[model samples]
Target: MSRSPEFVVKSPAMDIVIHSLSDVGPDQRRRLCEGARGIFWDTAEVKDFSSETEREGFIYKYFSYYMEREPELFFCAFSDHQVFGYICGVADTRQHQELYRCADHIPLFDDLYGEYPAHLHINLAAESRGKGLGGRLIEALEGALRTTGEAWGLHLVTSEGARNAGFYRKNGFTHEVCRGILPEEPRMLFMGKKL
Candidate 1:
C-alpha cells in the first residue's frame, strides 16, 4: 500500500511515507534491516553479537514473527522507494501475556513489561536520523492505537547510552526506570509517552 508523502517538520529536505510492514517483500525487509543495523551499530547499542550473519538472524526472527503474527501493528517508512525507518507495537493482550510467560525464564523480563503500558519498538536508519521521522513514526502508531481502542500511552525499553533516549524523550517518551551495568553495558531505559 502507498501513502501520501509528507515532509518531516524537523528536516525539510526529507519527505516520508509510512506503510504497513506486510506490504514489503523479503528484499525490502533486508534493506530496511541493513539500514537499521548501520544506525544500531553506530550507536553501539548492539555489538556483543558480532557478524552480519548473527545480526541478520536476530532481525529476521523478530521481524518475521512480527509480520506474520502482527502485520497491522508494524509500519515502515519510505522515501524514494527505499525503507528509511520502521516501527512495531504489540497491543494484543494475548501477545503481552505470551511475552510475560517467555520472560519468566529471563531474569529481567518481569520488571520490563510488568505493569507497563501498551507499546512498540521504533527505529530509523542513520541516514534518516535527526529528521523527525521518529516522531512521525510514533504519531502514526498512535493513530493505529486509537483505531483499536487501546490505551493512548506507549512504552519502550532501550539500552542506555544508545543516544536514542533523548530522541524518544523529544518525541514524547519519558524515562520510567534505569538499571544494570555501566560504562559500556547497562540496563535498558524504560520510557513511556501518552497519546
Candidate 2:
C-alpha cells in the first residue's frame, strides 16, 4: 500500500496529529493502550469482567487486535506525542477473517463480516471529547480509505442509544442492520457509509 497522508488539526488547546499506527512509537502505543482503558471503563463489557486483567483483555480485543492485522488502517490522533484516540479498521477484511472467526467471543455475526469491507472502530480520551475530534477522526479514516485500494466503505457495530450512533449518523452512515438481542433494543447495529 502507498503511504497515507497525515493530518494536523488545530485546536486552542493543542495541535492534534492524525496518522497511521506505524508513525507512533511503542511508548505511544502503550500509552494508547493505557488511556484506552478509560474509553470503555464505564461500559458493561468491561464492567462485567471479574478481574482487572480480564477487563484489560476486553479492551485489547477491540482496540489493539485489528492493529496487529492492519496497522495501516489504524489511525491515531495525537497531541504533544500523547495519543488521544484512534480510528482503525481492516482495509482488507479478508486478511483478518480467520482471526475474527477463531475468536472465543464474537462481537459480530459471521455473515455480517466485511459487508462494509473497511469497517472501523474509534475511541477518545476524556479530555478529547466534545471538541468535534470524533468527526475529525472519521474524516481522516475515510480520507485514507478512499486513497487506498478498492474499499466499498466503512462499517461499525454499535448499539442503539450509544452516543456513538449519533456521531455515525451525523457523519452520513445509515443503520443497515439491527441484531435485536436486547428485546426492544438492538443488541448491535451495523452502521455503514459508502465511500
Candidate 3:
C-alpha cells in the first residue's frame, strides 16, 4: 500500500496551516476569495470570473449556503497570514439539495450532481499551486468524509477546459461521466473516488 505523507509536510520555507472554513473570520474570507479569484481568473483555457460581484457572490453563497451547514467540509490552506489555497465540499444531503435548487439555472450542477453527495470544489492561488497543497486539501476533505461514516464515494464536476481535471486525477479521482449539461458552457466532467 502507498504510505501516507506526514501530517507536517510543508514547503521549504513556508509555514502552512490547514484549517476549516469556520475558523476563518469574515474579513479573512474576503481576502482569501480575492486572492483566489486573481489566480482563477488567469487560468488558461478556463472561464474567467474576475468580476468583483461575481467572485464575491460565489464565495458568499458558498459559505452561506454550503460551508456553514457542513463546516467540516470546507478547508483553507494558509501560509503565514494569507490563505493560499482552499477547498469546499457539500457533504450534507440537505445542503446539496439546496445547492441544486439555487443552481438549477446552472445546468452543470442541476443535471450532473442532482443526486450526488460530497461534491468537492477547490482553488489554489497561482503562487501556491505547485507545492502539493491540492492533494493535501483533498486528503483533508476525505478525512472529513470518513468521519461521517457514510461509505459513499466523493464526487466532483470540472469544466473540460480547466486543467484542474489533471490535479483531481492525481489525487485518485476518476472521470466517471461527461454531460453536456450547459449548452453555452463547456462540457462538464464528473469524477469520483470510492471512499
Candidate 4:
C-alpha cells in the first residue's frame, strides 16, 4: 500500500495529525475505526433510526462498506490519540457500482460512472466541525487518487438541500443531478468535481 506522508496541523491548543489508515498499526486502526463509526452515526443526515438493527444496517451500507472494501483509501484525523474525523472513497465508481449493487443492495450510479469515476464519504465529530478537517480529508483522498491516475474526477451523493451541500460546494463539488432511490425516500443531490 502507498502511504501518505504523515501531516500535522497545529491548532492553538493542540496538534491534529492526518494519517493514511494503511500506515497505522492494528491497535490504532481498530481505535480509529471504532471512533469513525461513532462519528458516522452521530453526524449522519439519515439518523432517524427506529431500531438498533436499522441503525446497523445503515452503518453497514454507508460506512463499513468502504472500510471493509477499500481500507487503503481511508484517511483519518487524530488529536491526542483520539480520532475526530475521516474520509474514505473508491477509485472507480463503476467497480463500486457492481459490488454495491450485488453486496450492499445500493442502486448503481451507472450514468455517472464514465465521467466521475471516483466517489467519497466524509464525517467529522461534533467537536471537530468548522475546523477545516473535512477539507483536509478531501485533499488527502484526492492526493492518494492522483497518485494512482485511475480516476478522471470525483463525485459524492448527499441529501438534497442539506446544509452540507454548501460545504461540498466550497470544496469544489458542483451539483450534477438530483435523484431519488425509492418513491418513499427523499431526493439525493449528486455532486462532482474534476480531479
Candidate 5:
C-alpha cells in the first residue's frame, strides 16, 4: 500500500494510531466497529432499537457487515486503547458480490461512475469529529486503494442532508448521483474521486 503500515497523529487529547484492521484482535475489532455506530447509524434510524441487544444487531448488520468480512481493506483509528473512528473500503465495486452476496441490494454506481474502482464508508466517534482526523482517514484509505494497481479512484454513498457531502468534496470526491432505493431510507448521494 502507498500508505505507511501505521502512523501516529497528535490531537489535543492524545496521540492516535492509524493502522490496518488486522493489527488488532477479534475483541478490539468488534469493539471499534460497534463504538462508531452512534456517530454514523444513529439509534433514531432503528425504529425498534428499544434494547441494547436489538440495537447492536441492527447496527452490526447495517454498518459493520462488510467490516467483519473484509479486514485488509479496513483501517482503524486508535488512541489510548480506544477506537475513535474507522474507514472500510472495497477495491472493486463489481466484486462486492464475491465477498457478500447481497450486493444486488446496494445502490449501484458501477453503471455511471464506473471508472472509480474503489469505495469507502467512514464513521467517527463524537469526540473525534472536526479534529482533521476524518480527512486523515480518507487519505489513508485513498493511499491504500491506490496501491492496488487496478483501482483508478474511489466512490462512497452518503445520506442526503446528513451534512457529509462537504467532507467528501473537501477530500477531492465529486458527487455523481443521488437517488432513493428504499421507501424507508433516505436518498443517497454517490461521490467519486480519481486517484
Candidate 6:
C-alpha cells in the first residue's frame, strides 16, 4: 500500500498528530495502547466491571487483536507526545469474529457483515472532546480501510443514548442498522456508514 496520509491536525492552542499504530515507534505504540485503555474506561457506557483488572482485561480483549494483527487500522491522536484519542477497527469483521468467536455477540452483525465488513471503536480524552479530534481520527481510519479495499463499509456499536451517538451521526454514520442490549447494560446501537 502507499504511504498513509499525513494526519497532523492543528488548532490555535496545540498541534495534534494522528498516526496508525504501524507508523509509531515501540514506545509510542505502548503509550498509545495504555492511553487508549484509559480513555476507554473513562468514556465507556458500560460501567459494570467487577474490578479494575476486569476492566483492563476487557479493553485488552477488544483491542489486542487489531493492534497486533491490523496495526494500520489502529489510529492514535497525540498532542505533545501523549495519546489523547484514537480510532481502531478491523478491516474485515470475519477475522475478528473468528478470533473472538463472537458471531452471536451483537444482534444482526453476522447478517450485515457482508456490507459492513469493518467495525471500529473510538474514544477521546475528556479534554480532547469538542475539538474535532474524533472526526479526524474517524476520517483517518476510514481512509486506511478504503485503501485496503477489503471492506464495503465500516460499522460501530455504541450504547443507545450514548454521548458519542451524535458525534457518530454527525460524522456520517446515520444508519441505525441494528440494536440490542448487552447483559446489564442499556440498549446498544449498531450504526454504519457506506464507504
TM-score of every candidate: 0.68, 0.79, 0.73, 0.89, 0.78, 0.86
- Tens digit of lDDT per residue, candidate 6, span 1-195? 432786999989888999888887788888888887778778765679899887666666566666877888889898766788988888887766554553334444567777888889888899899998989999999888777777888888876887778999999998785456456656667888999
Per-residue lDDT of 55-102 in model 1, one digit per residue for the tens? 765554434446556666677787655667777777643355545443
* TM-score of structure candidate 6: 0.86
| Model 4 worst lDDT window (10 residues) | 99-108
Q: In candidate 2, which residue ranges exceed 4 Å CA deviation?
A: 25-45, 51-53, 102-115, 181-186
Give the Cα lDDT of each candidate: 0.62, 0.70, 0.64, 0.81, 0.71, 0.79
On residues 1-195, what C-alpha lDDT tens digit does candidate 3 reach at each position? 111222344777877877765556777766655555554455423345879776656655444454556555667777656777777777644345566555542345443443455667777777878788888888877877776665367777776656777888889887467767548866777787877
* Model 4 Cα lDDT, one tens digit per residue, 100-124: 6543223435678688888898999
> Residue 178 lDDT in model 1?
68
Task: Summarize candidate 2's per-residue lDDT along 28-85 as a digit string, tens digits.
Answer: 7666655544564633343677888876676666766867767777777877647777
What candidate 1 gets wrong by more than 4 Å, as runs, is 1-14, 22-44, 47-57, 60-62, 92-94, 97-115, 181-185
Name the weakest run of 10 consecutive residues (lDDT summed) in model 1: 1-10
Can you give the lDDT of residue 31 in candidate 3?
A: 65
Clashing pairs in 5: none
RMSD of 5: 3.6
Error of 1 at 50 (Å): 7.5
Number of the top candidate by lDDT?
4
- Lowest summed lDDT across 10 adjacent residues in model 5 is found at 98-107
Residue 109 error, candidate 1, Å: 5.9
Whole-structure CA lDDT of model 4: 0.81
In model 3, which regions exceed 4 Å deviation?
Answer: 1-7, 23-57, 60-64, 93-95, 104-116, 182-184
